[model samples]
Target: MVSTALQDLFGGKAAEAVLLALFHHGEAYGRSIARDFAVSLDSVQRQLDRFERSGTLVCKRQGRTLVYTWNSKSRLASRLRDLTGVVYDGLDPQTKEQLFAERRQPRAKDKPVIRR
Candidate 1:
C-alpha cells in the first residue's frame, strides 16, 4: 500500500514523466530533461524545484548546472518506477522496442555534438 503523500508526489502527468526520466537515467540536468519532454528550460527547472520541495527527488548544483536525481531512499520512487514500467509495458510493441533500444543507448551530451 502507498500513502496519500506518496500519491501526491507523482500527482500530475508532467511530474510522473520527470520521475520516470530520473529513474531511467539515474541523474540528469535541467536542459537534458527539458529536451526529453520538449519543454522549456524554465518549465523543467520550476517543476524540479517543486519536486525537490516535495521530497520525492533530490537536486544538487554541479558547477553551473543543477542536476536532479531520484531520492533512491524514498519508497515512492520505487512505486513510481513500477507504475512507469507498467505504463511502458502497455505501450504498443514497436513503441516498447524503440524505448528499450533508446534506453540501452548512452545518453547524448546536453550540448550539441556538431562534427566538422
Candidate 2:
C-alpha cells in the first residue's frame, strides 16, 4: 500500500494515518480519525499525544471532544504537509476514495433510486 510507504517513512502507521487525516480534513478528533482509518482508538490517541507534545500539532477542546490540527507555527509543518500531500496523491484510486468517503448526511427516507 502507498500508505505503508508513508508509515515506514514516518515511523508508525498510526502517526501516518493521523497526519494524513489532518492534512486532508484540516482538523479532527482522535476517535473520528481512528474510525476513518479503521485503526484502534488507543493507537490514534497515542500518536495524537505524541504529535501534540512534539509541537507538530495543537489541540483545542470543543465541547466534549479535543480537536487536533497541524501547528502552523512549527517549522516543520509546511514541509510535512507537502510530503504528505505527495504521498496522498500517489495513493491508489480506491484507497483515495475511501479516505474521503465519510458521510455528511443521511439519505432521505423512502426516497426513490435514480439511475443514469
Maximum-TM-score candidate: 2
Pairs that clash in candidate 2 = none
What are the clash counts of all predictions, listed in order?
0, 0
- Cα TM-score of candidate 1: 0.62
What is the C-alpha lDDT profile of model 2 across 53-104, one tens digit per residue?
9888999999999999889999887788888888777776677667766743
Specify the highest-lDDT model's number. 2
> Positional deviation of 63 in candidate 1, in angstroms?
1.4
Per-candidate TM vs. native?
0.62, 0.82
Model 2 CA lDDT for position 57: 90
lDDT, candidate 2, equals: 0.79
List candidate 1 segments past 4 Å from native: 1-13, 93-116
RMSD of 1: 8.6
Question: What's the lDDT for candidate 1?
Answer: 0.60
What TM value does model 2 have?
0.82
Please report how far candidate 1 places residue 33 from its true position, in Å.
Answer: 1.3
